[model samples]
Target: MVVDLVVIGTAITLGPLHNSAFILLLTAERGVRRGLVFILSWLAGLLMVIAAVILLTGGTPPARQSVPSTAALAGKLALGLGLVAYGERKRRRPPRPRHAPKWMERPDRVSGWTAAGLAILLQPWAMVGAGAATAVDANLSSIASTLALTGFCVLATSSMLAMELYTTFSPVAAEAKLRGLRDWLDTHQDQAIVSLSLLLGLWLVADSIYQLVE
Candidate 1:
């Protein structure tokens, strides 16, 4: 479970879309406040998913080979397959011209509420769903299980959190560096998406099959 969550969380944090949007938030007017809001909103969404899973599982791993356990694994299998297919399609398609979304056009003018909403909107939800599915195995009564979930949340949000703090402390340097990072991300966005989707999807699929047959 910990390993699965770590992989999923890394995929989530490495997503180019949200990270690009976050850079915009950091460079906006009153960026510190907006960036904080974005992080809080992003964290809230992750917590909600994990919380719902914990509630359903009641802090216990479902009995292996039971209906609930099978269902959870099956859900992950389906999601994994979906990601694999999506990633393959992207990989085979010709690279198209990329343009910034209209919402990103005026990030400097984005309101606090808009920033929060963007945080929610920009989540790599497919990967987030994978995280939630993997989290179903969390046995919260165990210290390790509890820590794994906490670590997943922290790891998933680490990028945005790092940026917010970096900007707050060193606005001058952070601006140039973050902007450069954003440009690079935009240029390589498709490759990044394809790589993360295929690699993580294959991991989940292989793991799910192993668990099912074991």
Candidate 2:
């Protein structure tokens, strides 16, 4: 449960492409419905990862040197190295303006199923994997672990959740504000991804190594 808290903290902090995508989805025709579907899909993906960890560990946190722990640590290391490599690759690319994806341009015609699929597709798999790794330490058999994991899910969805409430409350005013936000998100998306991947990736790699060696 404790490690799960750290995972929640990290999950809440990472601002990925999904943030912008969520906003854009809200700006579309049938925006609310699509946005809700997207969010549910996103949450489901996170839950699926957690479920896998639970099944693997049987609701028990593994010892530092236990097989399950070592496997989880290895998973973290692989994800970290992959993200770091990805970030480095993106960083070395020539400086050029990045454009919004075609899906982002006109969310109006996007079907609900597409929006749902987009959530899963665009989910930060590496980061989510890291969370899943940490969740290996959560004892799902305990009520506390259940609560903590539930909390993690809510925190992970915090940003988009806020936007949904905002749009529902103030539709007209929200559009102008979200449009501006959406544009900034588009322009900076790549840089943001690179920075996050590099930073968190390094942290995950270091922590995994420490756990494996210490």
Candidate 3:
């Protein structure tokens, strides 16, 4: 369970697509306000997926001796295989320059609400789903498991929260350093995604298979 949590948290933190977007928001006019919105929205987005899954599963696992959790495991497996294929395909393709979305370009005009919306929109849904699925095995009926999920959220959101606080407390002083960070994230974004997807996808698929067979 701890291993799964670490993998999921790392994947969410290192995800380049949305993290880069937040970095841009932080660099905007009224960036402190915008960055706060982005952080809350991002955290909520992560929690919502897990909440939905818990509701669906009723927060209870079937008896181990009953049928293996075949359906759920299979679903995870399919998602994993898809991510692996996706990462491999991207690896084979030539890299192309990506243009920032027009909305991203006009960061100065970005409002809190817009930043919030971007957080929800830019979620890596596949990775979120995997985390939720991994968490299913946690017996959330206990306070300990509930706390564990909370910890997962904290760990996953750590990177963004760190950046938000840094930029907020020292916006002028942080600007140059933050921009350098942003540039590096943008440059390595695709490779980061590919690596994360492959690593976590493979883990999810293997774990799912083990659960099903047990």
TM-score of each: 0.97, 0.90, 0.93
Q: Give lDDT per model, in order.
A: 0.91, 0.82, 0.82
Tell me the spans in candidate 3 whose CA falls farther than 4 Å from its real position.
Answer: 65-68
lDDT of 3 at 9: 84
Candidate 3 lDDT, 1-214, residue by residue in tens: 6677778788888888888888888888888788888889988888888788788768876555344356666777888888999998888889998887998769989878889999888887887777776677677788877887898898888888988888878888788888898899888988998898899889888887887777
TM-score quality measure for candidate 3: 0.93
Model 1, 1-214: lDDT tens per residue?
8889989999999899999999988987888999999999999999999999989999888999999999999999988999999999999999988776887878888888998899899998888898888888889779999999999999999999999999999999999999999999988999999999999999989999999999
Candidate 2: minimum summed lDDT over ten consecutive residues — where?
4-13
Best by TM-score: 1
Residue 161 error, candidate 3, Å? 0.4
Q: Candidate 2 residues 1-214, lDDT tens each?
A: 4663465346544575888888888988879889899989999998998998889888889887988788988998898899899989999997786665787667898898999999898888778878888889888678888888887878888888888888989989888899899889777877887888787778878888988899
lDDT of 2 at 80: 83
Q: List per-candidate RMSD values in Å.
A: 1.0, 2.1, 1.7
Model 3 residue 120 lDDT?
89
Model 1 TM: 0.97
User: Which segments of model 2 are wrong by more than 4 Å?
Assistant: 1-13, 96-101
